[model samples]
Target: ADDDECNNVTNICGEWANCSNTNGSYYCTCEPGFASTGQPRFQTNDGTRCADIDECAVVRQLCGPFSDCHNTNGAFYCTCQRDYSPSAGPRRFQPGSGTHCRGNHRDMANLTESRSMLAEIAAKTSGGELTSMEVISYVEALSLSSSWHFEGRGDMEATPSVINTTLTNLVEAVNNLVEKEELVAWTRMAEDLRENTVTKLLHSVEQGALALGRASSTPLQLDIRASEMELKLMTFDLAQDQLSVSMGGDHIQITPKASNGSVCVVFVRYDSLGDILKPSSDPGSADYSRFGGTGEITVNSQVPIDVDADVTNCAFWEYDLGTLQGHWATHGCERVLVNSSATTCSCDHLTHFAILMSSGRSNLVAHSNILTRITHEIQSTRTTIHKNLCCSLFMAEFIFLLFCSVIAGLLHYFFLAAFAWMCIEGIHLYLIVVGVIYNKGFLHRNFYIFGYGSPAVVVAISATLGSKYYGTDKVCWLSTENNFIWSFIGPACLIILVNLLAFGVIIYKVFRHTAVKKPEISHYENIRSCARGAMALLFVLGATWTFAVLHILHETTLTAYLFTIANTFQGMFIFIFLCVLSRKVQEEYYRLFKNVPCCFECLR
Candidate 1:
């Protein structure tokens, strides 16, 4: 009764199929994957030939949608179609297996590309070989330097981990921007940041071999903030970013290359997984411009074209590469220049610059250190002007003019003080001969008032009547613009003449007494004493400014040079005569050095 019946079921089915044995009769049965063709359902009778069933054909709604189903000997597989890829579930599975597909591979590709590009840019910032893409991104092609020529690409490079991290963050930021549709502002972000890409394959033992594009999964903010070492302050608030700076009076110029140059971009690859873009929450009001405005800028022969003011205006803007006006307006605040390429901001007031493009070679930005210094000066000026009642009286409008007035007033007082002191000296001598002293009395008080008050009245009257005479046309102080400086010169000459005459008469009397013993003055007279006394009298009587008189009257070169030379060194001469040349001062210096040597000897 045992009929050679496929015993124990060894080798009864093919390698791709399953097997089972019947009763004592020993019949064959196809397993789950293999079946009999043209039979009822998926079952097969004994002795019927077993064949592979096409699950893809029998089931119409298999593997969900946008996927391909393929039949194998004993199993079937599912795969995503073009523009779609499997994101969830097993790739090789049953026909009705639940798997998902993603559609934003381009966004991921864009991210990967931009990240690589950024890394390349950061590397070049320290000075090295740069690609055309970097030149475009830096907008450095518009710079004044001729060295920014194009270097061909084709090297799929890896950058420092920190730079890679920066690129990764930037990619995520742009991806977020894309989701919010704010990217529509910039040439549809110039084709959603498209660029060149190269793939990298990796041999993974556990997961078999793999391939991918260079990119980061780490998300980032659209507002780009490079590391402090990389560049100046930069930010993009979806629509605009603000940079506050003050360049001291160094001439500013925004020099753009203006010439056309080649361009390049970055890319990454993931062979099996491909690339993907994931959407997040919409950008909140805090991350973007509040008032509706134009993100586009226009430039032709002039600076930035005037945009509608009703549109939201921020403090700064994103600028294209070019020469810009940076117009510091006295009227409106519409002068927030985003990309500044100006080389000539003024030395006065809060200048609002206009962001404009430039061509050819020139410095494109101002230094913040210089700007900060200027701001400090401006603040100091404000503080000083605040203390003056005259400034406040005029509502602080004529500060420069006031500064000129102050200098003029000082010059007027110099001569007045000298004349007053000299007159006092003469009166003191007369009183000494009469055997009288007025050190403390109504007379002394009156002398004090005349010495100080007279000069004040003179300067005040001059300033009121001939205010224009105070300063030069080009500068703030007295100049050759008019004979206005004569207000200072005229009094100086008169005082010199008066002092000379009075001192000369006094010196003549002393010399005559020294030449011959005078009545009851034999003990007070000597030729040596007379000469020394006369010199001292001339010095104390303010005769040093005598040469200056010759200078003011005659406009000859010798006189001019002499006048300048004297005045220029007048302070030094005073120091020499009073402190350096004095016998007491000489003794003091010797005493200092002698002590130093004595101390050293003691230490030894």
Candidate 2:
């Protein structure tokens, strides 16, 4: 009972195994850096098969910090990183040998000697001396490099490997008077050596012998070429909108005529930055001999530069992104705004990008907050280019532009659907107001055919004539200037005019037949208020629509503004007549909202 467990098995078990005693038996287990190879075992040290383990595979990165680990079949080894040296002895070590790397590469001899002496003193002090293992762990923690790189600071951080963060824990650990003075002396020596190394590197960089960014003394000049060679951004005096770009130019811009519309900018590089950054065979030289760029880019680009809006689609459009969902999966790169944060997407990754323009009166609101949302969409679809990804840049741009045209054609069909309903409402209003009696089945079927079929015929005929009809200037619609605007304007005006005439005829009929009661005034009172309130209802329905017609015909600044106002109020008048003034609607509104106040109070 008094004999120790380890003492009893010390002879049978090899140094690599630890033995544990159970009630009537004892088992030997291999230690941390050792394992059994499934061999038949005997109770003697020679028969027990405890073998060295490859710590690199077991721990993933089992070497000392700031070092590289290499694995062998049954053993592992570590080598210090660049500008670092081993703390124990030289710059390499075997596994289970403990921490072997520390900072201060330029003065390795002096710093290593000082660290060793301090560790020895800590191991053999006044109290119970610390073990060699404990001293190594303590010294390793104090000697490890702790300086962090600040990325946003860019080239300013300078990344000098000679300097290392101090071991503040050592200042507190040493209580002996002699050891404390030695700690201060070693700290000063390390600082002076680091400063001297940094000064030398700096001097070499200034003399053009060392390249800090792999950049040359002269700024790199890039020859810029563009697809639309003659295009230029319009000056403010020309129209207040434009786009263009030039390399080495004082000002950069990119745009075409509003009617022509849209352009793409591409970035190109001959070789990757990583390749140029590699060290040359000559120690003092770098491989970045031919790479050139002053590294300046100006956005100065605009969408729908001189383009105008039309009736069919919005001057601003939201993409139907579902159509493109799986088409881009094979590119190994996702669509993102060109920027450096996309580390996984190298500079050369290609993507299809489109700048779809809105047709809904963009000019008036384009420069204001109303179009700020459209600007954001353009930004989200903007392409990101990396230095390595210069290939296929123009091809992707062309593909994206073609995709927009196809999407616009599909969208034009949906726009025609709205006309389908507008025509139906007009025909129904005309028949009822004119007092034309017909079978419900006959009238409904004919109007439905005319409503849905007429718009489709117009769209197909216009597109067959030319798909460009929908790609007027900025939006996907009938061109305002190409007489194709008539596709929407003709049907819209016909519906509005027929309804207007119907309202007029109804008013005329009401005045001719109705008689006023002579309660307030004589016969003149009846003559004075012709049709009484009938005229008011007729004007409410038809007058708002007349404003649009007048604006198109006159095409004045005042009429342009008047049409914008009329368009906004048109929906309001429809809502008032169809819902607000209707008896059934009034009842439902009150019923739905009657308990709203009570419900709100309960929630509160």
Candidate 3:
């Protein structure tokens, strides 16, 4: 007789499969809600395997709208999405179970729904069934609902009650979990998950406290106690003078600056959270690990102080919502006093406050002294450097003043000389373009005498008339007072008018030459060159000074800007017109840079 292989100890069915016995053989089939990898029926040795079928993926809206379908092994379940709940039946249901999710819009408007939700969360948390993801999801849902209600109603008066209920219940649940040691696993979880959970809890509490403060105009104090934790909230009108508050055993004194809003302070003391938030042994871990292992005191004064500890820090939870992370920071807080039983803190702002203490007094004090010495040395060096810099600046100003008078006289002579040379240029261009008397040697001699000799005479007369007007306290230029400025502007305007007249004549001659047919190439080129040079000088030398004159006369924003730009780019215009646009100058530049490896390649 054939043996019943399905019933034998060495059954041939794979995991999640059922074995069936036939007349002379046995085959394997996947169990209900699972599918076989190969054929529906096959022997175990044929590489056939059974896998749980994903009903949710295969069927659309398997859990209906507004719900999330959670696939399980050989089964599936459904739960409502955030801000929704089942209209009927249990929270977790199956597809087509006559249960539909309904929006909690109306429910979230009042405190009743929030109370029920908080109660549920509290029960789950206390029962050790709430996960980190669930906690975060629930808090996010509550926050979203609160924000939505406020946006819809344009008020948050009703939100404080909901927030208050959430806080009270959450504290109770966390306290119960602490008593049962269920939260011990928090420290063992992944670092990111642990931090996210803590951040959410702290943020939720802070939001509740802020809402309460805003809703009430008068001073308010709420002290909530749990078996293993305590929460203290205080709201008071901000004052210019220092104000102090004491809670548990900690004390905080803050002098708030003038503000239009009230100040809300929250202090949470979690005996178990401290144990779970143990400092990492590795120094290179997260910033929270750097906190000492002594103990934590919450809000003004509540936790038992560790007097023997060497270091005490008054810190606040700095949460960055963008990154969804938080860490204790002592930026605006100072440790005022620390004794055997109590610690005092002073802060410049309001927030969730705590006291962090560490033992090992000898090592800490020694290290602190070394740090203090290093800091003092750094500060002293900085002070010396600053003093030296100030002295150098003072000496520089003094030296500048001492030579300013001499420089001003030179500038006056040079500026007049510049206009005198511009006048020579206009005359030269006029002679070239108009085919008038062009005496190279005679004109060159006269150019030098007029440019240099005339400006020297002007400077001499001006200095003799008013030597004190050569320099002013603000600048080394000729002073505007006592009509001294005209000494320079008058000559500048004369040169500018001469250049303009020369430019107009050159343009007329060029246009007349262009009208001639079959004109001499040499004459044509000369006229062209003269026109270009004349136009260039007209703007570079004459137009800029014209704008300067306008700026002095009208002093409008447009004239000031135009004058500034024209002067600033004067050198650039000269280079472009006299060198970059000139064929002879281009050849010279190429020859100069041809020997350079980079320039040679670029030129080639």
Candidate 4:
């Protein structure tokens, strides 16, 4: 019998090679995906070796398009590229797995199919031909389609036709059901379900209008449940046309402009929709404490309405495709008419238009008073604490009279350095908030150079040129002599001014961005956020130096007090705004406190 060399402990084969035993002889051959260095077959002393063959390097288009080929030690595998996925099986596979890279189309396909089905349903339900069963089916289909998450712009673009068809069909269906005395069936559904249906309808309508993109020649009109909608397409010439749409005693008129482009006006009047979509009362909810009353078209009686109240706002549904959230916004639309019976809106562009009636002047006045009182109390407390702290620092400075000149020089350098870093912080903020491009490595290198080196150079030049003016009699600080104090004051003031300008731009950009991206946010909330941002910038950028400069230019007790308070409490302000208010820091604090024994005991 032949010796089984293939199964022996000390096989006569190199790694990745197969050993074969025959009539009193055995041969070694490299396995698939590996190559023999010396020969195809060898004996124990033939000096043959096996090595992995990089099949990916040798083969082109190994994984096909929209895929990447990765080489392994002995073989190669394929994976779909970003934004693409395999049609079947695992994400990574060999060539023979029958899997192919494909663009994400599942959401798009569902939306497209749903839209087609809706169009068919609308055609069948038109002209008072709707039944209760058919109405239920339509609602179920719309709800199911709306529940599918839209992935990107492609999905949004394919959705407008579905929404248009839905509105037209829904209005007709409801009207027919009412005429047949079958409306009570849907009305008897759970309030939450009814609200969800209406909300989804509103969301679909808003998204459709946003994604409409172009005007159609055909007109659309709908009225149901005390709500009405009229959509018309017209060639709007900036120089020659004024578009007007009126329905259900409400009117919209606009002077067409070049910027308005080809316009399509869609008007919708909702009755019970408002009752369902009321603003949330939960304090932690996004819609909590909104400036307006319930999201309803009717007038609110809780707050007084003036003859020229500005309480009635011309608004449109602003929908964010990314978040799939819709909010009533008054940015582009304006109220042209307001009365007891009806309100008219005028807009530069076209969308789902409506009227938002708010609680008027009393609320504004009350909020303002409360904010002013709180601000005053905070200022008084901060001033008292800062005054005592400054006095203590002043006394300590007098005690350090041993090296007055050295102390003054160090103080000048340190203050300049602090301002330099503030300037850098402003630049960093601008890059993050406004600038399109940001290179971390580049910023890191430049920040160290300018933040530290610039202050060092300024101090070195000042000490060399005006060393005698380093100390004063009253304090171990730079003297007010020969305009030499400018070395520190000049740079400090400039940095403060630059930072202020940067902050102004940042606030403007933030407001504009919020308006565009978050149109659902109320004006009051926007203003409050901007105010908080400005306050944060004031402390972080050391803008209190402006008060100091004001006192220097023309001394006043108020300016002196203001400067003292701001400068002394700056660190606390930084800590409060940057750390205490930080969401991540708050979460960390919660996690830490939760693990503490005292906290556990307290909870127990």
Please provide TM-scores, in order, for all candidate models, with all chains considered together: 0.28, 0.32, 0.35, 0.34
Model 3 ranges off by over 4 Å: 1-113, 129-167, 173-180, 239-242, 256-261, 281-316, 351-353, 358-604
lDDT of 3 by residue, 28-94 (tens): 8898899999999988687889999999899988888778999999999999986578989889998
Clashes of 4: 1
lDDT of all predictions, in order shown? 0.38, 0.39, 0.61, 0.56
Ranking according to lDDT, highest score first = 3, 4, 2, 1
Candidate 4 lowest-lDDT run of ten: 284-293
What tens-digit string does per-residue lDDT give for candidate 2 at 1-604? 5455556644456667667666665567776667775533323444666788767767865775667987765566799875456778656686477666665422223433333433443444324343323333333332321111121324433332211111111222232211322333223333334223222211211111112222222222223222211111111211226433332211243333444322223222111111111112211111011111122222221222212322111111111222311110222222222211111111122221112222224432321111111111111100111100111222223333455444554445443444344434444555655678878766656755664566678778878887665654455445654566667667667766766675667666545544533455545655566544443344333445567687666545677677766644544444455435555556655666677996544433
Against the hidden true structure, what lDDT does model 1 obtain? 0.38
Per residue, candidate 1 scores C-alpha lDDT tens digits across 224-289 of 222210111111222123212211211122222333321111111111111111111111111011
RMSD of 3: 24.3
Tens-digit lDDT track of model 4 for 515-555: 88999999999999989988988887778789989977655
Q: Compared to the true structure, candidate 4 yields what TM-score?
A: 0.34
Q: Model 3 compared with the native: what TM-score? A: 0.35
Give the least accurate 10-residue stretch of model 2, judged by summed lDDT: 380-389
Ranked candidates, highest TM-score first: 3, 4, 2, 1
Best by TM-score: 3
